[model samples]
Target: MIEVTNLSKSYGSTQALRGVSFRVESGEIIGLLGPNGAGKTTMMRVLTGYLQPDEGQVTVDGLDVLTDTLEVQKRIGYLPENAPLYPELSVQAYLKMIANLRQIPAADQPACLSEAVRATALTDHLTRPIGELSRGYRQRVGLAQAILHQPKLLICDEPTASLDPTQIVEVRRLIRRLARHSTVILSTHILSEVEATCDRVIILLNGEVKADARLADLSATTDAVLVLAEGAPDATKDLKALAGAENVEAYPTPDGHQYRVRGAGGVDLRPAIYELAHTRSWPLRELRRDVRTLETVFNELTTQVRRTSADTGEMKAGRRGSDQNPSASHLSERR
Candidate 1:
């Protein structure tokens, strides 16, 4: 439901996004992964039409974000790192106010408010002033407001930040529940949260898009193989001698041993391992490719990008001495 193409934005000398591009299909829980200054917040702002891009195009549900600014805003619900709230307003009043502000018709406001409250588990806390509620309850207030309009696109920046473990899980489940209808773009530093809630992730670095992929695909894309055998006594030594074998860890099991073998350059070590096991009369009970965790994939991609950037910076520094900001006229080219 959202498409961003070559979206570039900069602030004076600091570039926030550099030709970043990605697509979010409807009902997909997308985790926007990146370190500080990776342009995640900038991208979210551009998507919400709160900030215009210096370059590139963004469309939410087939409407251009730049041309249909107000329309896009109506369809997008943005919750910043710290939500903008009125502490003095009671939960009920705050939601009603947000409903009116979202332009929901007076006739439909009640149903919308009720649904938002029920979904966010704020029914019991509605009478309490926002300032009097605990941090979790306050976060619920933020979430309640964002979805009060039932927008098609929901952008949450650190929605669970500062929340306790129980609160974080509650908010995480709440986000998942909301994704049943709205497209979610979750930007948080918590990798485990991303793994738990997001179906896909887009990693950004140095104002650029580094990776965009489905969680399943990334998890399955690994060069490591798991080997479990009861009869393979000297399998570790033989496995290490195999070509392309990078690292082989052998741990003794009750019956025999379990081995984790990693290969180089996406090599398939299964065939060699199987052949050797057969030749050596090693009864292999389990031999399969290892699945990578989101953390592993994230670390690898970010590290590669940082290394390449460092190398390129050294070369560019030796030649140009510095970088230049885009002139307003230059930024206007995308317009």
Candidate 2:
């Protein structure tokens, strides 16, 4: 389990994190999503004790990260965006080095090595030099090293970057498997990976927490119906007039006009639409509740944040200009 509260970090004039906070329960796979420069990596570093936050607190299993840095590091397995690996060392040798670095007992090294290799499917590539393996295999090697110590928490940043479709799927499956043994905090630009592998998601933007919720709750549909009907052009307008219908928007389709009918709270417009269609003899092609995908939700949140930041920047600029000249303030207010 992990808890971060009001975590803030800065690099000179740039604030990489600003009052970001979240909690992760044991055995949960959480996706950390954001655009570039979103402070995901900064937060991970702070959590892993690689970097100390300028303000706020982080605790792992009730242990303070700053005071118990070694213990926290011991409990975490980190695979950075670009995995740091020894090119000349064979996979087996690399894992052995990691086991020693992680302070695994000499007696337990073999079992840990075997388990990590087996779990990551690196049995065949153990004897091969890491430099000779493909990118996908190299990523497996990275994962094997991370789990070689059986850490309680796994932090993976872009674990599937630069891989082909098949490799991405393979890596995702591996992450899912890893979740059975360790809590996972995965950071990636891929939205589908979050949908496929994460139980919950935390979206970060401009160094702040934007949205955090279970994927199921975040993807829940509103009180709206998607209706596909083939009839007169006024069908959408008529549907808008139906009882409980609040808003209607038509989407172009080859076979019919697809209208999304939103209803007032607790209103069911489906029955009314069905009755209207029956009365008008219009052909109904499709009718179903509208559900938003993770992509849609992510875009909306991050875009809104971007617009807010732009507006704030413009406001600050206007205030600075007004401070230098009283006449400019009056003119700006008039505009």
Candidate 3:
């Protein structure tokens, strides 16, 4: 539904996007995953026809974004990081104003408004003033206006930026529902947002495309860890002889021995560990993967990119970003 090819953009000396290329299929919810200054917003702007790329081609549903600017805008619904809204206007009044601005015909306005309100679940709050609603409700108002015309493509930049945990979940769920009306592409640095909402993700780093794949395909490591109940017989010899086991290391835990089993790239060792435990009658307390998440893939790719740049003295230090997190998932929790 969307195509970007060798897209590059810059602000004077600083490049914001460099040869970024990707495609989005119809009805797919894609996450433009990146840290701050990773050109996510720039890409969003370019796609929405708000900013022209310094170089490259961008098309939406086979129409050129540059030449068919107004036509392209007609098929896109955009909700930026800070949604443009009027505090004094009632939700019903606000949506009416947007419909007029969108050039939605008078005869079709009520149906459009009704559909958008129902999709965003804003029916009950339609008569309330915008400022009187909570941030979550205000976000719904923003989304309602964006999709007021039922566009074919929806571009949301940081749709869940600053809401509380409950509000975040509410907004995320709403974005998912909006997918039924449009092909959604949302830009965010939050890994959990991508995990919870997106079918695929495009990772951006230093203004370059680092990785793009289905969310379920992201796996940073294939290693599995095994913890045997205390007093279980040593499996050091068995582990060495195990098929697909390239390396194994053992450490003593408080109540058991922990084994880190490594295998060839992309190999899954959890099933093997289970089978081994069953065959040897070894009492097992825990068997799990060492790591598997979009955050892991994000970190692994960013680290590799930074390392290569540093090795060649092409990387400068002190770039502000939340590239690494200390949380268990290596991502910030909504809390």
- How many residue pairs collide in each prediction? 0, 0, 0
Runs with alpha carbons beyond 4 Å of true place in candidate 1: 225-268, 272-289, 309-335
Question: What local distance difference test score does each model get?
Answer: 0.79, 0.81, 0.86
Question: Would you list the rank order by lDDT, best first?
Answer: 3, 2, 1
TM-score: the better of candidates 2 and 3 = 3
Off by over 4 Å in 2: 223-289, 312-335
Residue 281 lDDT in candidate 2 = 72
Candidate 2: Cα lDDT at 206: 71
- Stronger candidate by lDDT (1 vs 3): 3
Q: How many backbone clashes does candidate 1 have?
A: 0
- For candidate 1, lDDT tens digit of each residue in 39-145? 77888889999898999999999999999999989898888888888999999999999888888999999999999999999999998999999998898899889
Q: What is the lDDT of residue 49 in candidate 2?
A: 93
Task: State which candidate, 2 or 3, has the greater lDDT.
Answer: 3
What TM-score do all the candidates reach, one by one?
A: 0.76, 0.76, 0.77
The Cα error of candidate 3 at residue 13, in Å, is 0.9
Instruction: Indicate which candidate wins on TM-score.
Output: 3
Which tens-of-lDDT digit does each residue in 204-306 have in candidate 3?
8878998888876555556788999999988878887889888887778899898878777768888887998899999989998876577555666666766
